[model samples]
Target: MRVEYDDVETEDDLRVTYQGDLFTGEVVERSPQGQVIAITTYFNGMEDGLSTEFYPSGERKAEGSARYGTAVGVHQEWHRNGNLAARLEFDDQGKLLSRHRWAEDGTPIESFVAES
Candidate 1:
């Protein structure tokens, strides 16, 4: 179910709730001006799917996946100008596996992999 962020309350480690019950589905957060700022997916009260955040101008700023509140797979962040800023990968258990970063001008900044 789609819910406005302001209409929901956060409880116990940031679990989303609506009308005092754990929420499952999508929560949409909007800027004061009524622009969508973020969209998050939840399951059984925990983050469990793709979540995305946007810049004030409606450009995608970041996106990632999660399972039961633990980050998984690849997460990406972008500069407000829309250039890729960072990319991070995580193991199934949410351990950081690797990370790559770049400057807003598209210059490579850092790249790392876990010692495994």
Candidate 2:
């Protein structure tokens, strides 16, 4: 699979296509003023992966992956100023697998698994 982005931002999605076949990706979200708000992705035309990023103010807000049209994998949450608030990981079945507090920056603090 291959992916590309002309000017992928908080308002637009990062599309992924395989061999000219539309595989998956997120959708573009725009502000009422016509700028951008967040981009939520879909799977085969379903609410699967979603990445709710913030505007130009510097806030991560929310960004992550999903499976079978559900939230899964690594999920990032942040403050309004583009700061990382939390870093959480989930299982394939939408189960909370791990979590970690955000660091001073928006980067993932650390990886810690949850008890099964």
Candidate 3:
């Protein structure tokens, strides 16, 4: 993957710019203990597909789909103990369409629709 960035020199001559790849692939980040913390997909420097996060113990913490850098479609999150914590839906414009939350014991606690 080729990463492209623009350089802007600061007053002290320090350079900085936005960074990312211009291709599609999985980007893995590991914790200090060498455990996978997150796995994300990218397309044209934007998050365009499935992405996931993991708990320290390797359990899935969240899973979701994105398009053009915005969260879209069904996304799920879970508690550290593995119980579902929430489910959310978003429109193509990245606006949340609805959301539902659950308790640690797997009981539904709240649900609501997003105002357009």
Candidate 4:
């Protein structure tokens, strides 16, 4: 994946720099503090492959995959403390298939399945 930097505006009042494109490469976003906050991949200008995000403290917050700009497959989330948060599964059409949640302490919370 190509890596470059460009200034970008954000609603959180922090300047971000985007590295890479939404096609055949991975885009990495860096916070104004120079911390890598997110990394997403793209295929032919659409979101594809693995996507990941991290807390400002460098802890992973979320991880998932996208297919042609839509969320698909199994996705996972976590708390900044490295605790399990949620897990979701989706179909190729971006339809939710199943979902499960857990507390930061690893306590099971709830689970659900998609209709149809």
Candidate 5:
């Protein structure tokens, strides 16, 4: 079920309750002009699955996945002009695996891989 961000009550941390019950589904946050600014997925009141944030102009700003509130897999961010800004990888257990970043002009800024 999808719900407006204002309609949900935030509990501790990433937990949210909708209509007095733990929310399990998508919560959408909108700009004042009604443009979708963010979409977050929840499971049993905790952040899980994919969550995405968008620029006011509707370009994707960032995207990532989580399992029971712990970030996992690849998370990415982009500049408003459509260039990749950052990329991070995490193991299934939420351990950081790698990180890369680029400037808005697409120049490499940083790159690091966790030592095995």
Candidate 6:
């Protein structure tokens, strides 16, 4: 999950530098004005890697990881104020194993997976 490079076009018709990390290939979908609209990444065609999505204003929308194409790792989503909206977990096959959600003030609203 390393970002080789991005093919984003700048206002001057130049290629913008795409900065990426090793664990996940941080990809940013930009608008026509070179503003980051969405950020997404993948592993094996599914969201089984790392992804950090942002709002139009460059605020983090969601962030998480996956295994074998399943959400099987630490997943954290944030509100506009950067408060964790939800914390979730999954299995290797993308089955929901557990989840813990919160409001803007951090009230623990919880859930779990009951699969054999």
TM-score of candidate 4 to 2 decimals:
0.78
lDDT of 4 by residue, 17-61 (tens): 343322466668888898988987766666678999999899999
What are the Cα lDDT values of the candidates? 0.94, 0.62, 0.74, 0.77, 0.97, 0.61
- The parts of candidate 1 lying over 4 Å away from their true place are none
Q: What TM-score does candidate 5 get on C-alpha atoms? A: 0.97
TM-score of 1: 0.95
How would you encode candidate 3's per-residue C-alpha lDDT over 19-96 as one tens digit per residue?
A: 322445566767778788787776655677898999878999999998867899999999998899999999888888
Candidates in order, TM-scores: namely 0.95, 0.57, 0.76, 0.78, 0.97, 0.61
> Compared with the true structure, what per-residue lDDT tens digits does model 5 show for residues 25-71?
99999999999999999999999999999998999999999999899
Task: Provide backbone clash counts, one per model.
Answer: 0, 5, 0, 0, 0, 0
Clashing pairs in 3: none
For candidate 6, write residues 53-72 as lDDT tens digits: 77667888887776534566
Highest-scoring model, TM-score: 5
Writing each residue's lDDT as its tens digit, candidate 1 over 13-83 gives 88878888888989999988889999999987889999999987999999999999999999999999889
Candidates 3 and 4 compared by lDDT, better number: 4
Model 3 lowest lDDT segment of ten: 2-11
RMSD (Å) per prediction = 0.9, 8.2, 6.1, 5.1, 0.9, 8.0
Candidate order, lDDT descending:
5, 1, 4, 3, 2, 6
* lDDT winner between candidates 1 and 6: 1
Flag the better candidate by lDDT, 4 or 6.
4
Model 6 deviation from the true structure expressed as Cα RMSD, one decimal place: 8.0
Off by over 4 Å in 5: none
What lDDT score goes with residue 71 in model 5? 98
